[model samples]
Target chain A: MRISWITEDKHTPSVVEYGKVSGEYSEKARGEHTSYQYFLYSSGKIHHVKIGPLHPATTYFYRCGRSGPEFSFKTPPSQFPLQFVVLGDLGQTEWTASTLKHVNSSDYDVFLLPGDLSYADTHQPLWDSFGRLVEPYASQRPWMVTEGNHEIESFPTSYPDSFIAFNARWPMPFQQSGSTSNLYYSFEVSGAHILMLGSYTDFHAQSDQYKWLQADLANVDRTTTPWLIALLHAPWYNTNTAHQGEGEAMRLAMEKLLYDARVDLVFAGHVHAYERFTRIYDNKADSCGPMYITIGDGGNREGLALTFQSPASPLSLYREPSFGHGRLRIENETHAQWSWHRNNDSDAFEADNVWIHSLRSSKECWNHTQDSSLDVHDEF
Target chain B: MRISWITEDKHTPSVVEYGKVSGEYSEKARGEHTSYQYFLYSSGKIHHVKIGPLHPATTYFYRCGRSGPEFSFKTPPSQFPLQFVVLGDLGQTEWTASTLKHVNSSDYDVFLLPGDLSYADTHQPLWDSFGRLVEPYASQRPWMVTEGNHEIESFPTSYPDSFIAFNARWPMPFQQSGSTSNLYYSFEVSGAHILMLGSYTDFHAQSDQYKWLQADLANVDRTTTPWLIALLHAPWYNTNTAHQGEGEAMRLAMEKLLYDARVDLVFAGHVHAYERFTRIYDNKADSCGPMYITIGDGGNREGLALTFQSPASPLSLYREPSFGHGRLRIENETHAQWSWHRNNDSDAFEADNVWIHSLRSSKECWNHTQDSSLDVHDEF
Candidate 1:
């Protein structure tokens, strides 16, 4: 379990107390913070504390600030059939509330917030407020998040540390998972090992992330965890005009590694819309390439990106520009189901549904007979 | 471990998964909420999930709201030297920040927010906001709290659920602890058994609370948990002009029961200041009477109660009108220390310090010849 708080002295300590019950805690640990913020009249020191070696699936109660409400969380079960809630670009808005309402009732196991969390955009207070806004949901689930463009609130003339708020508030398990930066990391849960990559960081073949990604993929054991999923803020496959070609270069640089690793699915967000891509790589149908899905319309103030390419690619199996979230149920090592629910529709009627089957036994298989060149907007 | 969320309908389900590690959870339990809200512009269905039969002194991790940051908490160890923080009348204000800073730094195990959280009054939105404000602290530690005047945000006479907001948000373990109302409950830690009473609820001998209090105290096993601490909102013994005699009626009805039970200390708040009293009952010193300490000075915007009783009660030991909190360290089964700190002073200089020794075995042992009364208002 992780708990955090903010202080102004840059030295006020951060602590966490955890055990199986209240008061009788046998462990006491001090935590540290990274970066500082001096915005308006409010200044802060972000603190992060990690409590660990916890009993898997056991319920543990904890509190972050010295005297706040006690929060508890149960670790996920180690095996298959885990439910996962996937969404992106969830900002503080009425529509965001609608999306959360649906997501909260979905009864999923993992929450993947692929960047653009608060849309603070240099307005740091929004970031703090947004944390509270999502605490009801985020603090209660394993929200595996990544940095999006909006999280890159760079103030060229003032503070140089970008993602200051995001970094301080949500400290990912990067170090434990063998990644150097919170921007990217990997962790195992249920029957899948999730790779949360950084679209805002370096993606060159020689980059640290790339080398780590290669090693991480090489270490995956299909016998224990057969599902491999990669999450990034920007979609490599999209047919929407917004954020078109934004992640194309990155995809070109890293897609081969993922395909080689036999990743079953890739989730992303950025374009304020939803789109599901057919299993393909380098613009051609690939039986082994991971199926890509984008569900970015998470109720940000920015309305949905309604405009799609005039001539949609056959690879774009589904597209919709509406505020919603997705649910992925890993049925087993070989089969998983995905569903996208629009906020405006009935709770039972999914806007789109697809079942993905793993092809882990096939090694690096892909047919290059299709289109040689990929269209950016058509893949959104 | 317990978690919650909200939905439009009253039927949305609640769930908590907990065990040992992040993915080895063996327990999955569904939970439910009791009350909900539908304000002017907002609507909600509160959710509650409980995960239990947790191993004592062990750490467990779980989440609420379907998807959230996984929170971890350790069950309290079976026994002593537990640190308990005692404070009262805290509300959301610039002053509240100072109090929280000090309290957070003190590293207490149990946070006693004896009442007046948020200062939301009838503004129901502040209730939601208050939960987030104290979450950093309360979510970590076990904050044993009770209702104060501010929580008495009575609606129109037509509806008698005066504390609906407070009741919905802060659900105490009253039922689990044997009490029938969330307003009053008792929980044990180390050598101390804390009784959190409701000053707002009925306290007459015939009242349900009175009956419960009698049974709870009668059942205390002094051999194992030798210390008995009482916490309520309004100070039963105060010399401040504000809230003078506010708790007199209740005190008249319940003080003897506590005195007979050989209560170690009575902590309360309501007046906007801090005050300590020599052990006394029926306007006279009694070595066995519970020591009365009022640490209500927990940063509220209403400012402080500067005026004292004209002919200050001979029992008043110390009094101060300032913004701060107090620390109670149960050194052991026989000795405990208390300190009241001023928010603006150096950390080491406590306004008042006292080492209260237990007199549980010596019934009515006061040698009244010591002095009529003592006063320490001059010290503060």
Candidate 2:
């Protein structure tokens, strides 16, 4: 696992000393530090330390620098019965703290965020604040994230590059999954293959994202990785008035690919609301299609998007504008449970819950072998 | 394998379609593109396409971009009988072409270059020329390299960062080996574990490079990877008068770790001459010490270091001022052949040839197990 943090002093070495026991670090690893340019925001060096070849489902205690305080983390299991907490649009706000508190109460394996992490926008120093805000939980488990609209901190002539801060601070293992850009990448954990796609980046037919997605989907082996899930910022099947039609172009360019791959779940977060849809493809219900859901309720300063269009379609099973987080518990190879919790409720209110079956085991989808897709790409 | 190239047009998709046969690209992959900063020199786009999970010891025919020419490369084998060509200080000169021609005549699995690649030296356009000049050889085989003094294209204030072009163009699998910086990394190929150390980077006991090297060396399982080799610029042991004492500090900080690990050989450059040393540690001959060799005679624009200090030490086995390359042919697990070839020789002149026995098989040194080092780090 890779552990990254920042320090004011560049002379301090980037090192992580870790072991299986608390306060007793047996293993040490070192990483490189890089600094980026931000207008009206100059700061210290950012340290990234990658330590690995670790055991699955193991807890490790670590210290960042020589004199820094110690921290601990548990590696994700290699088998089923794994739980992943999904939080989105998580800005540094009071509600975000509540959401985190609610999340911390549960024992989960991984943290997945669609995007809009810091909500810092162009204020680069807030990135440091955001890092500190989530360091407690983020240091304990792997937090996989993607880019959102707000992450595009592009300026006129001074700072033309977008996502410079986001990319630098939140570097992903895109290269491991054959992704050229950290904006979009995939990871397989606990018999599940989760794809973090870049909604803000290019998604045209000839775009690098589209081509990579095609190749990545074609390369999945459903037999081993039974659960196929995807996450992006903009919801393709959102009914909320906020950010409507934002994902239309992306859906038009890549919906067929997902549908054909029989991806079990497609989670998105851009609407700042919660909405669940039936197994749908191209705005219509399809038996083999993915269960699309938008859970952008993790609290940010921008408040709740409480307005939904009147007369929701039949495909829209549930829709709500509330501050909450979701969890996907993969119980076994065939069955999994997905539930969302509202933060305001005194009790853990499971406002929406559903049982999902793996599309790999479904007779309707299992027959569509990966070879057919491979053949299309002329890949062996 | 990752294939990178430049396109004159930004619209051109960075795609590599590949297969096992000629003109039959069955598998297709897409990569990301980026534009970098140069004073006055500007290019369209640099595309880096990574296509992998490929079978080892197999031939792969690939085409980069949409309309680029077809190229082929053979992946290094997983077993013994692997050959690695060692060339250093290889600038784009006629001597470099001659050295390349001499190298191309024989087949090698991997190319180990210890820095000073293009010698563009801040004239960024020369980077393009160097890339084009070596494309035929580089595209066919993996050219693993590190940074050199010449690679530091740092200008006082305008371009303060060093190795911007080198880092962008020649991205290595440093992360794969748990390395945070591309400047230093280790890769296990065939039956050998090769460490590419950065000579220009910080190498103090408290530096990240030192910590990383310690951890990396301790993690190596000599039982699996029997042959342990290392490469770096600035020869630790040199009799050449051109660049003396350049590698003294680095050698002081790192020599003990390599010695304790029983490294079989260490290849270095930067002296602009060919010099080979006997098994030596500290300043004396040790049975378990690495046989350090300087092969900086890779035909750089800077002429050869014609002068060798009089009264050569007994440790310095061979020294010569000529443009040539060296090859290490690991014939088997227990034996290997090291030979240097002179560029002007009509025949493949094995000017300096020696047979090396694996240190792992030596009863004198192999007894110092990895556990002893791991115990020091408290690693499991």
The candidate that achieves the highest lDDT relative to the unseen native structure: 2
lDDT for model 2, on a 0 to 1 scale?
0.86
- Segments of candidate 2 deviating more than 4 angstroms: A1-380, B369-371, B377-380
Worst 10 residues of 2 chain A by lDDT: A152-161
In candidate 2, the residue pairs with backbone N, CA or C atoms under 3 Å apart (3 or more residues apart, or in different chains) clash, namely A26-B378, A378-B26
Give one digit per residue, the lDDT tens place, for model 2 in B1-380: 68888877878898999999999988999988877866435655888888987888999998888676888999999888999999999998899999999999988999999999997765576788899999999999988998877786754224556678988888888997888998899998979999999887788888888888989988888888999999999789998756556678788889998998889999999878899999999999998999999999999876688988899989999999999999999999889999999998854779999999999889888777454666646743
Residue A251, candidate 2: how far off, in angstroms? 50
DockQ of 1: 0.01
**A1-380 per-residue lDDT for model 1 (tens digits):** 56666655655668777667865566667777666444332436677787777766666676665655677666666677788899999999889988998898756677988888997655566777787788788766678888887786543223445676777677888997889999999998877989999988888888999888877876777678878899998789888866566677689889987876668899999889999999988888777688999879899875688888879989999998989889999888778899999999987778899888875534334222112112211232
**RMSD score of candidate 2 (Å):** 23.0
CAPRI class of candidate 2: incorrect
Task: Mark the 10 consecutive residues where model 1 chain A has the least summed lDDT.
Answer: A368-377
| Candidate 2 local Cα displacement, residue B143, angstroms | 0.8
Q: Model 2, range A183-268, lDDT digits (tens) per residue?
A: 99999997999999988788778889988888898888877889999999878888886666667767888888888888899999
Q: Score the docking of each candidate (DockQ).
A: 0.01, 0.01
